[model samples]
Target: MLEHLKKEQINPSIIEEIKKYRQKYADTADTSQTSLRYLYYGKEIWEAAVHALLCGENLLLAGSKATGKNVLAENLARAFRRPCYNLSFHINMDASSMIGNDTFRNGEVVFRPGPIYQSAVDGGFCILDEINMARNEALAVLHSVLDFRRTIHIPGYDQIPVHPATRFIATMNYGYAGTRELNEALASRFVILQMPSITQDNLTRLLLREFPGIKKQFAEQFSGLFSDIEKKCESGELTEKVLDLRGLLDALRLIQNGLSPYPALDMGLTNKTFDAYEQTLIRDIITTRISKKTESTTIFS
Candidate 1:
């Protein structure tokens, strides 16, 4: 990962600091998962996030769908060589679920540690996924943990001080259903970075990275197809449901496995929306770049 950072031309000083941090917390490193599936492409975003984490400030990644917020979060954790604990926040998420809850075992009450608590104790990276989905009041428990105090206070248990290497990375997608604006107090606790939508160049790079045997022309066409769908979503002609990067990738994989392009795309992209009219629009967009008779063999070398 450090070598990849050098390839991206991240600041040398920042890279050095990251090395020092890893060395200092070498014992906290978890080697179970060594690499990220996808590498975030934007250099500026990478630099900003790396710098913020190096300064011991938590990060809040805010962006629209398919902007690589979670990808970057995982990449950051991998870059720092820390164990990552993911906590998906919803309406039912509360302090007890986050910090831990009391459970009876062997006729005795035992405190079961949650992701946040485990991450704090182990100096792991805790990913707060879709943080805005949870009510603000439920998040109040994080105030001291995120701020200068760096501690978690449980009423019946001893105070737990956050490990020096522990860092929280929260991701929120604006305008998502059931998601509300994050409260000011929680928002002010971390340095926020606005994630940008994946660019055509980066999309192409991602395809080539994931499928090295894929032909260059097909890669460009696939990425262009996604770009068209994104533009349509922005114009309100189609909902964001069709703008599925994962679906597109799955379609390509299906194509590689012998499915025809159109049917593969139908399973991957067009069928993501149940609306017939929207599916037609998506099919038209797909036809503009991909041939209906394009065979699976033609996609790869």
Candidate 2:
């Protein structure tokens, strides 16, 4: 598969990393068994990111959390063989943290570069993770960096030009509390792509690919459980407890470790959310589903 990918002009570095991770984990296979494979519903988003990388356009990924925005961003970076530096956005983030900061030198104040500055100079990919969570003041510093003439200006220091290979990918979970909306000036700097919830087929493929040896019947049941949780979330019947496919995968692994499915599911998945009532309801739903599946399995076995 690595060889085939290489023939398609895919980055050798990315192909090498994929092979390296697979070998290190001893999980190499022709197909992925992870549930996230089926969760990819935004083909446009994926393709648009790819186009941006090829065309060297900075990108912005906007969606609700757990819709695979960051995952896709990382995957695209891996696929492109571009080194990625993730700048985690937070409320207190400042221009110095992104562009550069002044520091005491041997005998005077010197400019110490930040992740954004380094990535810009290094010609690597910069993932501005959760850009919306950042203060407008912080993002205001990015305006020049993202505009047509790619350059970042630090008031007290030299003006730096970004590398031709440098591309910026910003991701955000809109309407998520604690995040402010993107201001127009900053918003105009990026090409927006909306990410959607994972589709069932993709989710199933991801599970099967991630857990190659897991029983297919169980994989189907797990996928259905995720769908059920999603439905509950849409109906406002549950919190965001069910969006982590990794949690579900771990819960199943725990069951295989001799923990009863109910308890395993609770500890691995439901317990992640703090709402007692919501947690109990999720636990009950998982337990009922597992019982039904187990009974059917027993009859067949």
Candidate 3:
């Protein structure tokens, strides 16, 4: 995969740096962190990320939904051969939850490491998903860790220096319903990269890669369907919840499993949202873009 990236014109020195880190963490690389499907990153985004890693900068992937932020984060971890800890930020996230907490074990309280703590100690790549969802107070523990000092101060335990290779990749979907603006302090700690949604050509390539047997005509229609829904969502005609690439892929999987296209797509796209009005609008979009005839040839077979 790194070789493929090299062919894309990513900096050689940056690739060498990743090679070094991958070797250092060779024994600890988590297979799960590696993506099963090839993650398609735009050339510019790929170059920016590689340089940021060389600088030992934490990454903040700021973008709209379906921009492949999480996918890229996982792909980076794999390319660098690091153990990955996927952490989801929530409204109730707290410092203790991220660092460590006192736990009763063997009749004594012991400090159990959280994802952040373990990643810091083991030189793993920690993926903080939806970084802006957690309250600022809850994210305070990340300050020192993400800064130039690269150390996290645990209240009960003394400051622990993060392994030099440990990196944090955070993602944020700004302007989404529940997302908030990232705090400037945290933003400053990261190399913020604004990600663009995958383009039509890339999306078409992704679809074909995942579903190789899909018919050309139907593939084009499916791609246009997603584009249409994305536009509707962006224009406020549909909710973002209905706009999901995973849903799209899963629906295609359902069709492969012998379900017809309409119902299969419904399972992936329409049923995700419970609102009747929203469902109707989603169905309308699906109806317009996808029809029974699109399933004439079984792509799965």
Q: TM-score winner among the candidates?
A: 1
Error of 2 at 7 (Å): 14
lDDT, ranked from best to worst? 1, 3, 2
Ranking by TM-score: 1, 3, 2
Task: Tell me model 3's lDDT, rounded to 2 decimals.
Answer: 0.83
lDDT of 2: 0.71
Cα TM-score of candidate 3? 0.84
Q: Which candidate achieves the best lDDT against the true structure?
A: 1
Reference-based TM-score of each model? 0.93, 0.76, 0.84
Model 3: runs farther than 4 Å from truth? 3-14, 23-38, 232-241, 270-291
Model 1 agreement with the true structure over 140-198: per-residue lDDT tens digits? 99999999999999988889999999999999988657768999999999899998778
Q: Report how far off residue 121 is in candidate 3 (Å).
A: 1.1
Clashing pairs in 1: none
Candidate 1 or 3, higher TM-score?
Answer: 1
Worst 10 residues of 1 by lDDT: 28-37
Model 1 lDDT on a 0 to 1 scale:
0.92
Please, what are the lDDT tens digits per residue for candidate 2 over residues 1-301?
A: 3333443455555556555543443422213323223223344555556666666678898887677777777666555445567899999999989988889989998888887898788666789999888888778889889998799998876799996667799998765457678889988888888777777666766677666666777777778888888888889998665566668778766666556666677777888888889887887777766773453223122
lDDT for each candidate structure? 0.92, 0.71, 0.83
Q: Candidate 1: where is the Cα deviation over 4 Å? A: none
Greater-lDDT candidate between 1 and 3: 1
